[model samples]
Target: MLPVSSELTRSTPVVEYVIGKRQYRSLLEVTSTSTIRGVKKKIEDKIDKPMRYKFYVKILLTWSFRQLTWTGLQENRSLDDYGVRNGDTVRAILTRTSVTRELALDESSPWRKDVSEISDRDTGDWPRRLLHIPTMKSLTWRPGNRYGGKEGPEYEAPEYAALSYTWGKYRDETAEPISIGETEWPVPRIEPTHFTVHDFRRVINRIRRYSGTDFLWLDVACVNQGPDSDEGRLEVGRQAAIFRRAEKTYIWFTTLSEKDWPKSADPDYLQQNIGLFEKILNDPWFGSVWTLQEAYIPAYSYVLDRAGSKLPEISGCGDGTSFKTFTRTCTWLNHYSDTPRVSAARDVVPLLRKSGILAIDSGNPFILYGAAARRRATNKNDRIYGIQQIFGFQLGNTAPNKQTQQYDVNELEIQFTQELLKNYPVGSQMHVFAGSPNFGRGWHANEFSELPDKLPARFIDIFEEILRLDIRRSQNQDQQNRRGLSHLQCLCKFEPRQTESYILGHFSGQMCAFPDLLEAVPESSKVELLVALDYHKDSEVLADLESSVKYLEENTRRYISLYTHDRRRVVSNPGGFAFGKRLKNRHKCRLAVLKLGVHTRSRERSHDVSTFIGLMLMQESGYWRRLGFCLWRVWHPVEDYDKIQWTEEEGYFT
Candidate 1:
């Protein structure tokens, strides 16, 4: 025993210590001068454990296993003699002898009676008819008789737990045949020395004991991987439903071991254990594409380390007694901040939150597309098909169904975008465009270039519409604005009445309307009408402005003037003109300009000139009820319009 120093007894500092790996919150604080034997007594008192069993303390110096060392402390010596300090970890390992019988792995094992094989018919219909899921009889000790039972009644699908794990590289020669009751199933080719098979056996046994059910749904054993068939594709489509309907989902991380667990009874261990749990969550299982839905959709989920030890459930249901109830409650709690403590397995919470959003309103599937793009899939097509169910698209009936066109990735992407635009409003459509690669990354330019070649003719028209709304003029100077005012005049021979009266407006004084001035201006003069529209808050008004701009753009030679009060301009260029010089002076030419409001110094730099044009057209045509004033500006066509560097002051018709 080490000798205790005289200073240790004089001033004792309270030190926090963890008892075991499972109890993170069950921490005990004792003074530095407390004897090892005295600390044990306190632990017993805190845990309500009998003193008949012996407990030993070992310090954890580092998180890595290589750096971990155990130093035994004599029961009679104080912690100060062993160099114990405040906030140091002290692990308690029960030394009492207890016999734990391992489950026998023979052919006649009792678990064999509960095993069932998934039939081909069950795989055909998939989630709609979830009966007879496959279960492995034993992880080891394979028997020659693959099918142990005689002809019997077909097993109906029952409540079962689903396994989510990564399948590392495997070879044909490495495959092992394991018995599933009566059928001999070939286990994936995993190396034997790695103890994956052994760990799987232990996991199955523990799950059975804890869940009180022997039925389990493992993808490798359940899905038929036969070549030259569409069954695999069909199964992939039904993945969302399969995981959502499961009683519970188990996420098995091969990287986690006994070293990562925290004691359930030690409260001080809670802080230290967070780092270990974070490492466990970083395992490749969380990154796998197929595991995203599996980790989230189920009513209850649990995580297991390599040692078959279960991690604390992150979510809980109401009543908080059962794991399922606790998970349900925790899921709701995660949405709020009252409970700031995040669970170690909270990585899957985002997927759960998204699932809830999809269920409530799946009109905009753009977010789902973005989420799917971030994940990886073995088959390129599976990238889109895999997330179809999450967006509420049904995986049509079995083979020979006419709806197979939906499975095509190209067709599916188009359909998804089309549905998004159709079901949502114009603002939401803009948001989808902002999030999608086609518009977000400027990839739509390439799509537009391909035009009616790679894309459908209808899509070409759609692209044209979007372009007209986004840009005042296309790159090609020869083509007139397709939907401009000239086109509107050609389509409908309509004339407007002169407006001599004025009304109070929001930003500026009452002014004469533009339609009244149009009749007074000479037709031969280089006259241009500038219509400043309100593109601030109303979506309907914005849409009208877009239509009016398209009409004005068709007459390219005619000077079209527009100004805006929007602080942050949505459109890059408002007017068809290259520069704002044409509206700089009111004496140069006949130009009728309207101003609803003035642009502040901060907003002048990003102001959209076209927004004013659209806003003015809406007000003059009586399509918009808002008040505005009509002012006149002189147009001076610059010799080098493109070369002119117009400042913000000259850009706004002040």
Candidate 2:
């Protein structure tokens, strides 16, 4: 052991910084670790802005999450964390004096707004000089000789802790919230309660009355200066502290062009058709209302990149098709399934299918439509624009309560559909919404068709891309796929219009090749029907279909041996694959399996033979469709066989 080399005992120090050691180089990468005071020292060393200058330069960085430097410089939050390793490069350069002078002359000086640049002439004016410096509360930086990274001991500052603890009342699902003890750390909640009274218009008015005060808690306008992993871990906690602790959460729902929310409409609410109006620009009200006491608004909006809870405490109020909770959205991958966990950055519709909740969406348009409305925020279009659409409100025909509750809108939709699918279950067709994202007022006939023919996820991404389009050339309808998970800014309408011709065409094409799958099913004594949303039940359905197909092949294989693909000619043994006369669409589509029960049969054995056969047909159809087929058959048990009716119903024709 005594013979071990010196390398075994020697260790390197973690830091290189010293109080007086001056290092000179060019600025390579500015990061969140760079404190406000530290940045100033660097800038002072380089450009030599007058040592006595009062104000610091302010740079607004959007599209990138930033952390405030102690010296007032904005730095990227990501680079500050998991970076700054021993081998990472660092550089500091001497700044040009004239460059600093030019910076001092700029009117955009974030530090000393509207004041003359500090000069030799103002040396005697102590009060004016004092006014030039931003108060500690305003500046993001603390005095320092160099940029200090955001990762020292005690990452969760006291103030941030208080805020999250306050807002925790909103997002947590568990009502019985326990305190953060030594062992149990609190998980900061995301988004706000599903929906609150979302009268952004009312909030604007309220804040306007209290403007020009230091108390405003502007959520969209506050600083999220967390710089390290430890800090990020505590982000939501800070959000609760800042927002709930603030006097009011200023919710800026819309940007106003003329004292009102910017005029916009989305009958389809195609994400492509809408543009996000940044409040700072589209609405003049932002500046006025921003001056009020501590206020916060959850501007949950749609943009190229999904915004993190700009701060954890700040909830993003629903915007266009985007709804209340940006943290977790309810989307289904398949129909008859539950919601799935989705990231805020992507669209929810596809995620819905990914989670299996949307498994039946393509077939069960009823659930698909309701799920879509839920994702898109039905309340926005209805309530937010009710004043505009009811009694022809927008066309200058605003009248007395011209409509009943919006609940009737979706309800009337399903009832209207009953004229088509008479067997559909009542609750099976759902329309749940929170806040007036849409459905606040009347809709056109086109909106009604969304039911039964849930709009494709294709349209969702197409429209949300509108925010980033070159408006003049937006006519390029194909830019959709290149975009991220966006939505179609569509309203949930129930009045019928021609179902998208393309979708019907898709199904029709699929039906053309279904006969082969019918040949694959094994029919035992008779085919049993099985329909289960859970995958475990898939085996049961398959088992029954296998038996049915086997029996059919054994019994009817003689008769059904390949004539023209029709029920009339079961050519028991069509010598060879003989050519047939023209194929008929009638017989091809005639074999479709229609569903009578709204929910999947709980006890398949209890269903009457007629229902059982119907279930078998439905189950077979799904497999057939996947194999690219359309035709199927149904058979009843001997007891219920007499009660079965194979005759087509009037409205049941696809």
Candidate 3:
């Protein structure tokens, strides 16, 4: 046993420690002079028997996973040597298997406090410069010219490779500063100062081995990063073209310590590495907004661990294990399940590929909105800037522009929503149920004028007329076939605060009544529903609604059901629907169903289910704002459309 410091026996400091990125919290008892290796042993022992997971601990500089004060803790060094104090939080990272290599792979030594001067000479309309890394020890950058489109020779042997990564917060004092003309660029190092020639060479060699290109175009190194930089704003607009023109793109996922690495000679090396790849897929790099287009635009993309190895080398499955294949496999694993956190990063590229909208430049705004919403950006406006390029349209104003400062997120969001609707073709019959109801410069209480104003005015008018016709027919039929069902509690008045209330109430009440009307009908239908609330900004009202309606969790795409206004007994078929937030102190809500353009394909199933997409709306200052969207699969054929009642013109609750 190692000797503890003789003077450190007063009281044991109980350090709080968390496990991995999931942050499973627990406590560690230690004297102030406990050696770093000894604490690691205690952490390993804390795990329940049967799972002997190995771990390495680092005292966080702050309450974040990104910033760490130490690169690797010396085994013989006591916690006090690193200034570890009582009640401080340390992260214990778990490796997949036993490690056999030394942990000297962090390549942050080249980064210094002084700025590296680079030329600001203009090259082309897009990427201004590219780093020419001919060898591991040499680094040179030169102006970059625009690539000839895909048919050009650049498609095969491109001028440069692009880099996509998360710019995590690091200690500002230790960050690398680069000067391009008048702009000062500060780049956060992935690891603290622990530079060794061997480790730095290993990183560069591995990147060279996988990417096949010596020239790299990284945003931090190339673009002007000043707040009011026109160059930065211009590059932001051309990101899509820059990425699309690259020979390939490299995604810099968090580097694993070389110390926890398994040897190639290990029997389970291949499987262990695959499992490690799966875990690292959950890294925060995958959740950044800018990486979405970076992953999708490149003809080929690679995932590299800065310290250890490239993904393909780790898999040992040869080049057959493409990045796209891995993401698709993970996405498929959680397709029927509700593991959105695991699937959120994997969903973007696959969904974009499936939509096939990129080729034609006409994409679905709903899909794009859903994708953008799932991602995160330090600056709220970056989300708008990042997604706009994916659709081949540049925002009128982009980052570093004075107009896009932090205080203008609401205005930016409203502008982005309007631009999205105006630029894309989402069918004249469809309307986007987006934006906060309480935002903007209108007396309607939101930035948006009514849906009629945004969409083709004639189209919304005609659609409303079709609903008016249906309501008149339903009223006439209701008088002739009047039953004593009016006594049933009106579904509009039924205030259900729980899923059980919705599930149980549907079976007990008259099917045609108000609150019960929103419930799935025909009993035989298989309905899968989900409610998505902005987890970070959710209000108590939305929290209660989410708890009351959600049967599944971790879903990015929300689902909900709304009953048709028609009182006729309808057969229901299995379908899925998503819903959003409701107003805090408002109960006067109504539903409107709009028919999407004609479905022409012949039905393959015995009975057809016509899909009716509905919106839950609330009146604010005489105009309506959407609460959420719902999809209903009621068994109404084309001939029976007259039975559906359109809510009254102004949506006055009956």
Q: Say which candidate scores most in TM-score.
A: 3
RMSD of each: 24.7, 23.5, 25.3
Best by lDDT: 3
TM-score of candidate 2 relative to the true fold: 0.22
Per-residue alpha-carbon lDDT of candidate 1 for residues 404-485, written as tens digits (9 for 90 to 100)? 4434655455444433333221211122111112212221111111111112222233323332322211111111222321
TM-score per candidate, in order? Answer: 0.39, 0.22, 0.45
Q: Which sections of candidate 1 miss by over 4 Å?
A: 1-150, 153-157, 168-187, 191-195, 258-274, 314-366, 394-412, 415-436, 439-654
* lDDT (10s digit) by residue, model 2, range 74-123: 43332234233211222222232234324322333223332334321221
Report the Cα lDDT for residue 70, model 3.
Answer: 49
What C-alpha lDDT, on a 0 to 100 scale, does residue 339 get in candidate 3? 39
- Which candidate do you rate higher for lDDT, 2 or 3? 3
- Quote the lDDT for 98 in model 3: 28
TM-score of predicted structure 3: 0.45
How well does candidate 3 score on lDDT at residue 633? 36
Can you give the lDDT of residue 483 in candidate 3? 14
* C-alpha positional error of residue 437 in candidate 2 after TM-score superposition, expressed in Å: 25
The sequence of per-residue lDDT tens digits that candidate 3 reaches over residues 176-272 is 4322221245432433333233444455456665667766667755666566776577677778767755655676665444333323322234233
Estimate candidate 1's alpha-carbon lDDT, on a 0 to 1 scale: 0.38
